[model samples]
Target: MKYLMEFEPIIKKSSSLSPHTFSGLAGVCEYLAEPRSKEELAALFKTCHTNKIPFRILGNGCNLLVRSAVVPGVVVKLTNPAFCGFENLGNTVRMGAGASIFSAISFCSQNNMAGFETLIGIPGTIGGALLSNTSDKSGPISRFVRKIEVIDSLGIIQIRDKEEISFSDKGNDLRDPVILSVEFAFEIDKTESIVKRLRKAWISRKIQLPLGVPYAGKIFKNPRGLTAASLMEQGGFQKTKVGGAEICDRDSNYIVIHPNAVVEDVLRLIEQVKQGIRERFNVDLELEITIW
Candidate 1:
């Protein structure tokens, strides 16, 4: 308690805990800390770790769901501009973990970086994308990740090369490390070519993903050879609503939450959808969104 009180000046209380996640869902957290620099972040991590304080890292929050109105621990957000920067090398780019996927794509297009054009429409920060192994038809973001820099619970910084890491459909095996930055490798291409690819990726996403809704990205990952969207459609989940949370008729994979929706409503709908899918297809769907 004394250690936590020491953060009284540096950390914000519940009233100031509004997160910038895409869902626009309000949550109640005890303490929220936004470190302006890596040194500050490390100091905070050190204190929390040494004192055994529970903490959760909050990224762009695009693919997250706040399941409980009152979160139990400290929330760490790295949205400071200092944590969001990019450096261009000849064939690779060093990107801060806080940088948005859109920003990375724009940089790639402008620099004629070819490989990442497929990531244009992905939401959230680079750190979130990497942690979730975000991908589309082309590939996962892990494919472009040459190296990752992270800080451990002890606030010790380390760098892991691609070979030293493993990523799967479940997500990256990051050992719960706080990602500092990622170095991405890309091929040189004509700026026009990169632009064309970026346009195509954007158009494809606009068509397949739900639009004009307050949602937390995808609800479930595709199960093996079957698509979650099609399964939801087949399971008769379209237009299904549990309180203010409803399955998007346009895209069965997305659950749109109304302004009045509570976390329980969203969670209940998810259970119903999952149960329906299990009964019909005999497949247990894995959730893609992080329930914080």
Candidate 2:
């Protein structure tokens, strides 16, 4: 409670988190801090560290699902212009962690830079994408990452190169509490070619995934050598529903939330799906979305 006064200028008490996420289903967090600059963020981090208070970073919230219970500690969101900057550096681009993935892809496409087309339709910020190693058929975003600036739990900043970080389908190895910025290397290409490819990728995603739906992206990661959606369909989970949450008719891998949905509805549906898949296919489905 004493620390609250230290950052009172940037902290909101007992704030609802539903509007921050794509699913629009979440409870409240004890403290929500929106620091206007890096210095303020570092100071806040240091305070939390010294006080032993738990904290988590929030991005675009496209792939997050928060529980209905009140979340204690701090939730940090980097929405200020200082943290959402974008810069073009010829063969490479420098992006603040708060920059949206759509903006990054569009910037690269307009500048005739290639390599980000594979993530055209994905939502969330650059930091969240990198943290989860977001990818499609082409590859993970880590492939283009040249380096990243991050703040460790101790509130110290460090630079990590591509070689220094390891990425996989599971996630990245960067244990830093905050990603400040990233430099991504890209190949030179014609603007028309890049835009054409981007358009194709976006259309393909819109067709396959559950677009324009009240869902929090994919609920489960594809098991090795198998797709989660196919497994769910095979398991007869298409009509499965728990409260106001139900398997998306467009894509069984996604759970659509109705107006009356609560976080418990989604959690229960996820558990049921996991249980059924485990029983039917003997495979343990891993979650892709972050549950807070």
Candidate 3:
């Protein structure tokens, strides 16, 4: 606890009680460290490593699921403005990992950048999106990422080009690296055209996905050529409920929680849905959200 005292000025105790996750559900955590810069993050990691204090990186928390049991160790969140800088290159846009996807999309629209319009309604920061391989049928984030900057396990900075990385259905194939920034490549287009395309994408998103609800985007990944939402709906999970967590009436892929929904309720509901899908369709479903 001595080293933790060193971070007292920037660390929040009992972070799990009021987690930053979109689910608004969490158990108590020992600490939450908010580092304002790359240097601060490195220092925090180094100290934690030396002290053997476990830690996990947190972003916009749009795709995370915290358990009901108290989480031991620190939860590190990169939220400082220093980690949200944006730069526009001729054919590339550079952004800090802490920058939100909405901000990036807005930047692209204003700068007449094309190819990222499909990512309009997605949540989470740039780093979280990259880590989750955020994308749709059009393409994954890997498609536009030209280069990625990260802090390795040893608290050292490193950069990897697009070709150097590998992506899978689960997400980007990162080997325990903490993403610091990303440079995305895009095509230049007319500002009007970009705005039109972005607007269309947003409208489509609003129609297909649930809005004004406390729900995690998608609970399961689409398997192969089939969509998970379709499978869930076909399996009759649309009106299913486990305690206060239930499948969204509008979007079968989303799981909406009531004001008093507990973490166990959501977990049980996910299990029930997955089991039903497997039993009915003989297809295994993989979860898209990270269960912490």
Separate clash counts for every candidate: 0, 0, 0
TM per candidate: 0.92, 0.95, 0.94
- For each candidate, what is the lDDT? 0.82, 0.87, 0.83
lDDT by residue for model 1 (80-174), tens: 88778999976679999898888888888888888878877677898888898987888787888898888875798888898988887668778
Better of 2 and 3 by lDDT: 2
Worst 10 residues of 2 by lDDT: 208-217
Candidate order by decreasing lDDT? 2, 3, 1
Instruction: Using TM-score, give the best candidate's number.
Output: 2
Candidate whose lDDT is highest: 2
Residue pairs clashing in model 1 are: none
How much is 211 displaced in model 1, in angstroms?
A: 3.1
Model 2 ranges off by over 4 Å: none
Name the weakest run of 10 consecutive residues (lDDT summed) in model 3: 168-177
The local distance difference test score of model 1 is 0.82
**Ordered list by TM-score, greatest first:** 2, 3, 1
Clashing pairs in 3: none
